[model samples]
Target: MAKLWILLLLVCVFAGAQPPERSKAPKVWDEKALAEWATPIAGLNVRPSHIRPKEYYDLPVVSLRTYPVYAPGREPAGYWQRIQSTGPKPLMEKKGSRTATEWIEAGKIAFEEADFFHLRTLDPKYIAEVRNGSLAPSRVLPDGTLFGLRWVPTKQGVALSSSNCSFCHTLYLPDGARVPGAPFRTIAPRPPETFKVWPVFSRLQVELGVLVGSPPFLMPGLSVGARLSQGYGVPWKSDDPHERLKTVTQEEYEQLDLAARSSGGLPRWNGSIIFPAKTPDLIGIQERRYIDHTATHLHRNAGDLMRYAALVTSAEATRFGPHEMGGPDTKRIRARFSDDDLYALARYLYSLTPPANPNPFNESAAAGQRLFQREGCVNCHTPPLYTNNRLTLASGFAVPANAPASLEILPVSVGTDPSLALSTRKGTGYYKIPSLKGVWYRGRYLHDGSLASLEEMFDPSRLQDSHSPGGWRPLGTKTRAVKGHEFGLGLTPAERSQLIAFLRTL
Candidate 1:
């Protein structure tokens, strides 16, 4: 009878060890259903102002071959030759399997391999500079992995490549394991050495644009630069060199300088703003109804993600201008890919799964979970998904009357820095309640990448006037308090540590 009881106990333990059943929720976006739902919302005289143009919907049946064009009247630079010879090729061919899975596989290849931004043109120069010690190697994380940029091999030679979505969303751990769809924390520090490469590269780009003999209207940077200069009150074509100096105050000039420096050595066509947003994780993105920190892009369906990818990679400057101004460029770029390709890309992105948590639940973590619930953190970051997916208004941004009523636009402010939401083109007067599911891998918390770690977030020192400078705070702003998201501030140190541990397990 004792032996029989032991066997039954073992069976019960085995049953308890089995993983819980996952919810059978639909992962893919249903465009028709979304449209049907939106129809009634639209009839109420509230419409989403940022809808993609009709040309986006009418994509080509197959991928088209596209090449980078240089500035007119300039000879082909050595950089152009290196890029043409060694740059990574597009994954989408003229002919391939049209199945959804195959397309997703193709998209995965593209995500890992494609240089959609044409950043690889400077690869040869960058390699030579690093090898010759003219440029310092990018800082490696504690895990011995360089996060910002990596090189991949091509047919001709090695290609210095920037990330696609995979670079931003993937995390490499100390154990030499990679977690796809995790928020990448180990961004390379912006060394001053990297700035030297830009002037040379920009000159080469202009020369190439001239040599390619593209019409002035077709020149890549000209119109965008002009538009940006006008918007920022800089005179790109000013006869007087000191025209900007006369109009702008010293403080305003300094602010502009600070903003420009915030781009971190990237070639930014648009003038920078006070605070740029952190890259969001793609894990469980299908469950997210809104896109971006500002909730500027409404993610009603997979096509919306596709549209977003297309716009960001190519014509992001278009967002600042009227639709008519950027219509031609948008249409031309949209024509390169088919509806199926976009759908497949979205599918591949949605398919990303967060890595398994190596940390097991313990007494401390269990206590922390209780604290998480007790402190009202669950109110905004609700569970199952860990985000209510609602839009909370920033302090200064006023919601327009024409704004869609379907969105959950809340009135309360979280008291975090509102500069990005109030100032940038991506601003829609709202910030999305981000999910906390994979908080273990994410760093530099908050919308603007202000707080470096969960501990710093809970640190009461952040409320003090002499708060230490870190994250993206400029040198002058060091003593400025990092305010807002005061949920865990009142917790005891032990409780805070427990709360952090519990957050890591999520």
Candidate 2:
């Protein structure tokens, strides 16, 4: 028995304790691969260009750790004083990342730690304003940290910065729990009026606008009208709406933006202010076949996700054919994450879990499930992951003979408005049929987020111009018809309720 016990001890000691080995990550910034990754836009038939791999990799890798911003009076004692004096600190080193679990943890740190805009506030007065509740990003974490803001200590001073992924992607529930990778509810961005007391932070906001709100502008020196002109126009296409931006003054541009920039939709780089895309929920991005609403890029693997992270952050070429948006003065300083950091971020994003469904799959949901099948929703939504994972053509686009065979294009358009699919810099003339796996948790509906609720989506009244949309609308739009996706509209009130109940349970 002593010998047997000794043998068992030896067996336990020698056996390995680790997860299954991870495959070597593919090289994400391959020029040849990037050239072929995106689907070309419809009318112009030109693919959005990307910067050379050298341009991407040459940027300095900054992996500084970010600190949480506490609401007024809620921060731990001495948190403010300690952080103010400290210099920037690196979040992690590659030497410590051996196992998948370790890499994922590092990735989470990288995700939460990286900051885009460094609003330098050298004086103690800036901190006082933050603590006094005069200035704070709206969404608050349960611990009282502002969800969208981070305090980043630099060599000069503590700067206010936006948290990397969590700023836009995190969803806060009524119970005070946070769901990472869920879509964020936007609080109206603070107008410049609030920034009068903090001049440094306000100036930084203008400089940072080149990276955040108006990233498509290659040069920061141009007037708002010129920047707008260069930022969003499809040069090759004669009918591009962005052409008008060249003639507008700064005040005119502001007026246009005031109306175009709605709550659910904000114009992104290569995205149109007139046809802004809604923020996507990143919870199940691993299961997706394409990226973006227009199926702009193929989601080939983790490498692709990493490449996307790089492209969005700093690598965009802004070169569609011969046109360079910023002209010759496009040079600027930009930050990058190491390839390993990006790989870990992709892995962490893939690992995001959907929250448990509070809606029980009882009789009502079951009946709705039957109705779902009877209405043939199964053809598109499917089961399990709840998406068919196919691309559907927009109303105006005709599939070209050269369309990649790899994409499962469902030739028929859903008859939805085709403006976003046809007009934007990112437009590819197709919209991926979205998955309904977490429909219950999604606060907005439609690619542009025109509807606020599932109930609002099913209401036939929404098709009329008199209907007041429950969600986002263009600036001047008080009432406008929300068209298309006419499915499930014919169902009775009780039937629609049942269907919604079943959808929530998903």
Candidate 3:
């Protein structure tokens, strides 16, 4: 009995219970939350409003887990029959009395098992095809479950959910280990070369404009023009590159996706195909002050985190200023997550820890640590959390003198690509200074994921026009300069090695 009690105590410590952090769990779908759900688009400084609470609560609640998808021949005997016979599983139920550790455990399950808001489907055939890219037996986890695809049960029926936080956040190491919440992992089966992805995955209402780059307000069928306009068009910018998407052919759209995919970037809604932002590492998200590469939302508290999940999932607003994204189709509230479910998710995200650091603190790393300090990388990326949690200006962006005091701005430009800052709907005129806590696990760098490695990031050759990008660039393009964030480019080969050694240890 004492040992069992000790084991329970250890579990709570690992969970990092912080009940006081959230004064009291706020009703996630409250009118007050909807009001401040979105931080306005940066330059225009206009917040996009969302659907009313009545509309949000009117939708059905989802608390189901998707069954694990195994490889083609790896399924246990009678497993399919067992899962099919099983009824809907209510994943999280609010209990009158429960420990904080219990809440976090529930959140962890939802984080890994919950189907993405925009990617659920009842089709069985398409679920099997989601693993087409991973034909080898070695591609799956130790338990033989495929990385992302799952068979989720809903009131409608047994459905194959396409993506989850694990889809983008998991780094599938070659040795069969996965680091959940690490950046730049694409486990979803790629759309066909023709760019005609699983059309069945998105039934009329089973998608989000921000998530899949389709039109938000799809009433009848929409043209690629309407889809692109809703997903990437900035009516505020007269010379918006997305305006040309109206005339863009299917082949052209395919090329754009391929280009973005090659470098581990995707043009999410309100973001641009030409200026895609990299998927963020969620391992240390609890320490972050802002969300999105452009700092479009403030990470004030657990309620805000809960709201973010709800926003990206189903409540995204497509309107800005006087311009409407979809002329014919009105904005719709697709689905909603319960307050307890979202709160659980927030706690789970907060409790995530980095995988064990393989790189040791050696003499080289110690010298490199000194170099890191001397180089003044600490101003933006302060230690402990390894980030000051402030927003830095991008070049060519005029900082509004009357900007809100709540926004902590460093006013220093790294001179990176400002297109994601200026042209996209997510543009906040500032980029959130990212933490360097787990760069060793992070395979990609920069706002657009332009570099593939720390060695490549500091390579002066990357600044030259003839240099090839180690990471993703345009599909067929050969060479282009990866400009900006020129720090550590002047280091000698030995010093560079030491610097990277120190960075990996973090």
Largest lDDT belongs to which candidate? Answer: 2
Model 3 spans > 4 angstroms off: 1-24, 33-37, 94-97, 124-142, 186-220, 330-333
Tell me the deviation in Å of residue 78 in model 3. 1.9
lDDT of 1: 0.54
lDDT of candidate 3 at residue 114, scale 0 to 100: 74
Write the candidate numbers in order of decreasing TM-score.
2, 3, 1
Candidate 1 lDDT over residue span 1-506, tens digit each: 99999999999999999765422113222344333232111111222223343434443332322222222223245734665565544446534335555656766665554443343444566556533444333443444433344444455565454445565566666565776666554443332233333333334444333111011112344433332333222222134222333355434543443433332322122213335566578888899988777776678877677765654444233332222223233223223344444556677888888888877789999999999899998988899888888988787656666666767876788888776555444445678899988877776678866666789889999888788735556435656688877788999999999999998988
TM-score of candidate 3 against the unseen true structure: 0.87
lDDT ranking, best first: 2, 3, 1
State the displacement of the C-alpha of residue 356, model 2, in Å, after optimal TM-score superposition: 1.8
User: RMSD of each candidate?
Assistant: 10.0, 3.7, 5.5
Which lDDT tens digits does candidate 3 get at residues 236-273?
88788778887776567657766776556556767887
* Model 1 stretches with alpha carbons more than 4 Å out: 1-90, 93-101, 120-163, 174-176, 187-271, 315-340
TM-score, per-candidate, Cα-based = 0.67, 0.89, 0.87
Report the poorest 10 consecutive residues by lDDT, candidate 1: 209-218
Model number with the top TM-score: 2
Candidate 3 lowest-lDDT run of ten: 186-195
All candidates' lDDT scores?
Answer: 0.54, 0.73, 0.73
